[model samples]
Target: MKKIVSLLLTATMVLGLAACGNTDEETPETPETPGEEETLTGTGEGYGGEVTVTVTMDGDTITNVVAEGPDETDGVGTPALEQLPEKFVEANSADVDVIAGATVTSRGLIYAMKNALDPDANPWPMVEEEEDPSNVEASDVALGFGISSLGRKGPGADDTETQVWSINEVLASALFDGEGKIIYLNVDQVEVATPNYDGEGMPHLSGWPGQGGYNIDEDHDEKVDGVTEDTEENFIAEVELWKTKRERGDDYKMGISTWSEQMDAYEETFVGMTVEEIEEWFEKYTSDRNGRPLKEGSEDAEDKAKYDALSAEDKEMLADVTTSATMSLNDSHGNIIEAIRKAYENRMGLEITEAEAAGFGVSFMPRIGPGKDDQDVQVYSLNQVFANTLFDEEGRVVAIHVDQLEVASPNYDGAGMPHFSGFPGQGGYNYDEDHDEKVDGKTEDTEENFFSEIESWMTKRERGDDYKMGISTWAEQMDGYEEVFIGKTVEEIEEWFDKYTSDRNGRALKDGSEDAEDKAKYDALSDEEKAMLADVTASATMSLNDAHGDIIKAIRASFENREVINLSVN
Candidate 1:
């Protein structure tokens, strides 16, 4: 009876509409069936995984959206997922403002939404016309980046002292005005183990995480403190978890203020000064012990009190800066001043008007050369790559700064200058020319060189000509390679690497390789390919992906994770 009543009502409504139209062939456009809502779903690729977008639409307008990308990074991608869904609804369109430091995830969410709304209309790979860079005004400002490392001793197994490699970096582009004054800066710090660093350093596999992960149950896969199984997965996981002190943000407890807050205070204090002036300012006001601003009022008997003591005028000059950043920016903490000074040395012509973004990246990988060697003589090597890039609004690289560092255990030096390949529990020897015997850097520890050897892990850029790479220094070659990176997109840079590099060893295709396979591969390449990379090979012939460094990975990541900023070009 209810179905018959509904059929009668529907027929009556149709008859009324037909009477108003006065035509049998006329049909009315149904408006979303009145009070009915439609749900849609779409997916797109994210940084480390896939992003799925679900939306409920009220007619043609987006009423609600939910984006999920569980595999995205904790601080980067997760934030985007939690934040962008609301923005999608507010905009009522797939196009929305991008979240800073998560460009890859932003694209994922946008594309997913586009497909969800109308896959047929929007297409899977929607292309948009790019705004020409020439149409935008050329910028007058330049930018730079830097990282520095100093080592110290910390507690090891039981109560013994182990080497702790302290590393600090400033990414920032240190946006400079035409007069060469700094207008912007971004700083962060991370320390790595020099054999076995304390819990304060980078996410060390065998040192801290290994110790904890080893005890965390059967499901964990890390190589625990020299006991668990070692694999590439373990190292990669460690790298993935590593974060700078600034990235740690509020998690890096400082009692009075966060690490980022302290750095921000200092960054603000240093702006408007040239690098030379900054050095002069540091020389006059910073504490010798902790690198904080000199204080005038503390009278306690501690070493810090003595370091903090200052005269009236000197303290007055630093009065403004001292209040906000009382913590150390030194080896005791993070050497931000030194990093900035080094940054000035590496400045490049990167013009950007309020529309560009910058990013800093470091590729750290542990290298263990397997096969062939005595168990009595071996050491560990840590290769680190640091890069800072400025990206145009069109997503092309505007400028870049890159440098690399290789640090080894003291025992590595004992092996030889070029190589100390062995398989073991031993330190190399230093030769005594007059005595014609193996000296200190010897198997046993000496009073003088023990502390000295542990505290000096220098970067290649600092070593300069000393880090000889055939006819060019490591710094010179790195600069040359950076020129090739400029003006290309990240995709282009990656494709260039694939085209010019050797798959076997991950280096440029060279004629003088020790391996016959590499030689054959180089010979097999067409003349066009060889000529394409000729300019690069002339300066940088070393492997970009081998044990030396992982530069391409760093380059890609710099773009993947960038912070958005705005400032007039000079």
Candidate 2:
């Protein structure tokens, strides 16, 4: 994205009126000695344009410098014209000083100083590069592979742009604010061929339905008419794909059905096979249809020859597959899961956990085509994802998908479907790991309900974050266990629990305080339970620290928005 500059100026006028009044007063004031005007001029150029200035003052500080030129880069030289004092502003000028990278602009400013008095007072140019000892120190140490692998390596300035644009479309909402949408479409088709019959004829692939074996293209009218005679094996398979487009607002969500069986077959069929075998199978499969084979030799040879004619580049290109499939996944349910993952990533400030990654459900497509004839096979996968959210003062995801997930699920099942297997016209196995009852007979609904319970507690107590409520709930539960839960030394808490459970016959802790063990637990209640806990006691403290870290991150973001250098024209 190109950087753009815009300038806005606001000025206010005030008028005051006073009723007629007459007063007689006599006062005399003597004129003091006129102070000498110490004149100082500075010219500096910054990231954008240049400005020059001359200040007339009586002290070490110039106190004021006016600038005129093309718009200066915000947060840069503009500070010189604002709140900065005279000494620093002069130091930032070209004749007196240059604002580093804006040297030319700084010179331009100095040249513009003709408007000021005392041309002979023009200061000779002195460009002194400020020594950044930090950089020098950094260079002194060898940042070898060990350090680089730790992600401590420095990146070029353009790397930030790349990160922004890697998933630019998704970030569009956050960056561009819903000016455009990113969509992903997927389509799948099979590149199938029959196996060649060796001297020892191989068993025809007819054991499974939907599997390519002993099958014929009944639609082949010429072959049906018996006009072609040939004998060959055939290989048949199904291809899945998808397509994504940026359209409408960002809230658009699309999905499709995927049959992993086809994928499984693909893995078994072509993934590990040599190119020779693939071609042979294509020939034999295309030749033999039903019980009859098409024209032999030259036709098959023509096909093989055509394939051979492809340049190495063509072969390399052909090996790739790209396509898309898109369907309205859930009209209003466009929260493409990317945001959830991002929230987790930002929250944790680390690579995602495997559980979180698995829940993300993002993948790629293998091949794509309009149908089968104009098949363009290219591997497609989800790149960077983005979302735009409309919040009301307080930040919260209201309308999701303000700019949905845009991925290129080419030539694969872009549709979010798991493997399906069951008796034909009957129930089949659902391979959806996310389906209800995924965890210990618990479904998404169960988790939702659990969170809902927590939410109820929050609403009742007016707590703002789930972590707060979760921690409170855990603290309450721990109340009936045996320790002064408040600031109890870690050892004390452990000891208390051990003593409380010493004679409990190793029974799991129950939810009431009817027994002696329960009373001991209740007596250990803390006034303020771990209000930031996410799991159990030990984990709760860690969670509180994590929440604090999140708060610190937000603070840092706020700090970054503030100007690094304070400038005033005084």
Candidate 3:
């Protein structure tokens, strides 16, 4: 009877449809019999571990699902299994979604099916839900990195005081992500103020009489009635010079005759700056010490102005260039280490000997040499590189041994000049002291012209003293005289030289004041006069300049592309 009733209703519905739709062109596709979505199955890679899930469905609804895990814990993964089945059922008409913190497992289950048996079933709805994987809780495993010692000190508190220097540097490196960094730190501990002096380093401070002002108040009759204070009369005079040398590195080498000149420059230029401004400039950049922009609200405006000042291609090039605060933190660390080392040496009663102090000077200390895991006791310093060597009381070098040797400036050949082996355009040259090598008709290459062999490679139009003689001589010798001479005439060359000399002379006339006076002199030169100082070395006729710098730069840039070949020495 139920079949008969269904037949009658089907017939009536067919008749009604036929009567109504004589010419109906847009009709929904016929629906097939209800079927379950086929469960998907595949291996899924996850940060935590790999997982596999299987699902079961009925018609358009998911009746059941099971998730299996190899590494997943029961308590942690059970939540995923429990919540996912319900989530899957709730999204029966739509694609499956992954739960936060259980994304891998949720996804593993949802994607387990190859295709939906139900045509309306959506494939992946987790994307729309946007679940976060970071929410998953997990135990953190310790990761280790290489560590090297930064400094040295005695055992116990003094040792800690010394080692703190290196530890601080490591912390700083970790914070900065390493743009420019010091290789390592040197540290030492100075024991001061024994019970005899009641913790006030009085005797130690009083060692240098006029070096440190000693005030003895005999009338008061205190336990230790003497106090030494740093003053103009006895203070470490020119602490400023020491500071400048440490910071500038090799810029402060001075002659005794030029003492007045240096003092005058320091007084004039430094006097204009307030202590606050000086400190600010000297202070290194740190994350905690970040400062607001000079024009904070108008940063976009400022950027636009800068952008407008440059070409489109330059703007694109600059897009990759990160403009951020460059910290002098490394210098600060060096300063701290040097100060501590000096103080410690003073305490040890190890007089840094005269012979040891011969050239520039050297410090004495127990140091570990390079290529040693265990400390190799030795003395080291920046003497030979930056200055001369110094010896200690026992006829041994009092140099500070360092893990890294950045200032290890080994001298070049017989000439006492520092070696620049790794520098571009510096290598590949031989010299004869007593020769006036002619470049074309001019005696341009002399022993003083070191980079003669590499002049033809440079591309920059405006060359420097490094190129002036060497390139011209090379061009003449190489039968490339016409090539070199095509650019500028003899008059033009003379004019360029005159222009350079005139500029320098003008600066000299103003007493080389790094102030408004020097600027006034530079501004006084006419445009035509300035134009005369061109790189006329390279004209259509000949190259007065060598392109060695350009060649070396290109080689350096393409270094990454070069294939490395390993040859077995052993």
Candidate 4:
């Protein structure tokens, strides 16, 4: 009986040992096999609002990460969100460096990633609250104004050998928050040269592009009349001699210099400065020939030393360049500053002194006509006009006006008659004879008579004058086209541009249907008018397209910068 009991105990012990080993093997096998990728999403407070991050892991290894913050500012917090995903994936961990300017957003992104990796983990420390000075309120407003000019010096009586032209565009944007503090200020300038010439031509001027008879070598050494290179001391001596000659009223020309290279220096000084401060600087510096802050014994030791190192002749040359630059600034920035001030006043409903309502201006001079060919050089001039309405908080246009100014040289034919080229001047239409009228009282041409003739012709044509122009009068077509843009947003206007401006297959907005008045007017036009209609419509369409492009560009700039902008309906 004792032997049988002992055998039963041994069997039980063996069975228990087998069961333990099996359980241990199965437990580890279940977790060892690779499982499906796990994805988790978490959100945390960011600079603007909740920032979300999604993390995907394959077993214990991080596979992918994505973060998004829609409410963040474009150039600030947005950059942090864009950069954090790569860091999370590479480290296979949530710890990462915070972006410099976007600390809150960066920390939020990291916290969200951590949460995604371990949902049950303790939450990250809350971001410390800090006052934001740039926070915008509903009542906050900003005003921006852009102006451009194209100036041309026509062949004058004394200096008729060459023509000179310059184009400059300036944009002044000022942001005033709800607290009436100018939080942001940006001023940009773009200067474009004319097509062919490079500064040197008639009147023998002494400035950039015109060498003033002085030849400068690559090392900036100056020589005159094939003479040997002048030493720095000798150059200074010659300048001193010239000063004596000038004191005695003898005319002498100095080497030319340009202020274009110094524009950035001038721009840097204007930034972060108030309008009054900028005006004061302008008044002070522009009055003298320096065109900038005085460099002699400047607060910046480097600048003072550099100025001291320059030769006397070089110093004088720099002064001349600065003087020219300051003069240009007076001519250009004065208008821009005044425009911006008026724009601000208009936004606040203050009394404005300008005749027209506040609006930005853009001017471009595009060379039209034929390319270089020996014969038949085509002459063309294009003046583009863009008008945008400025709206109040209620979406009501507070200011609406159109401005037309003649800045560049007018397009003239060989006979000195003003020629309207492009789509408006199809068939070489003569403006003078085409509008002349022989009245009972007077025979000479007059503005009233000219317009009267055009109106009479249009009226007669509309009344079934058998002049089949295949189009309505220019006045009717333009009025109809302009009506299409009323009350439309900038984006909406661009969307509808092609539909209204197309002249293909009589698709122009003014090209009438079977029973439309425009169709009847077009069908009743004379053969000569009919022949001119296609070309005229084509030209007008081109003009409308170009103007629309410019207007859209201006409006987009305003919107992108988060400013209140509108287009003029009238």
Steric clashes per prediction: 2, 84, 36, 13
Stronger candidate by TM-score (1 vs 2): 1
Model 2 lDDT on a 0 to 1 scale: 0.26
TM-score of each: 0.57, 0.19, 0.21, 0.33
**Measured by C-alpha RMSD in angstroms, how accurate is candidate 1?**
14.2
Give the alpha-carbon lDDT of every model. Answer: 0.62, 0.26, 0.28, 0.41
Off by over 4 Å in 2: 1-33, 43-51, 59-64, 73-341, 345-406, 413-570
lDDT, candidate 2, 48-112, per-residue tens:
43455666654332445666545665544454444333534556332454343233344455554
Worst 10 residues of 1 by lDDT: 208-217
Candidate 4 wrongly placed segments (more than 4 Å): 1-133, 136-165, 173-186, 195-278, 284-287, 294-379, 384-408, 411-491, 500-543, 546-550, 553-570
In candidate 3, how many Å is residue 263 off?
53
Per-residue CA lDDT of candidate 1, range 1-570, in tens?
A: 644876798899889886887666757576645546899998886666678899998766689998999877778677779899999999999889766546567778888998887798756555565543322222567777666554333322312322333334333347666677887677777743333442443444432211122211122232124332344456455645666665565546442345676677777778888878877777667766556666655453453464455566655666656544567766544466777876777677654444477777777776653211233333445577878787877777877778776754333422222221111122333222232222233433332343344334456776766777675888888887888888899899888787778887777787677788777877888888778667678887777787666899888877876655545463
Worst 10 residues of 2 by lDDT: 143-152
Candidate maximizing TM-score: 1
Better structure of 3 and 4 per lDDT: 4
**Model 3 misplaced regions, further than 4 Å:** 1-43, 59-61, 73-77, 93-97, 113-368, 371-570
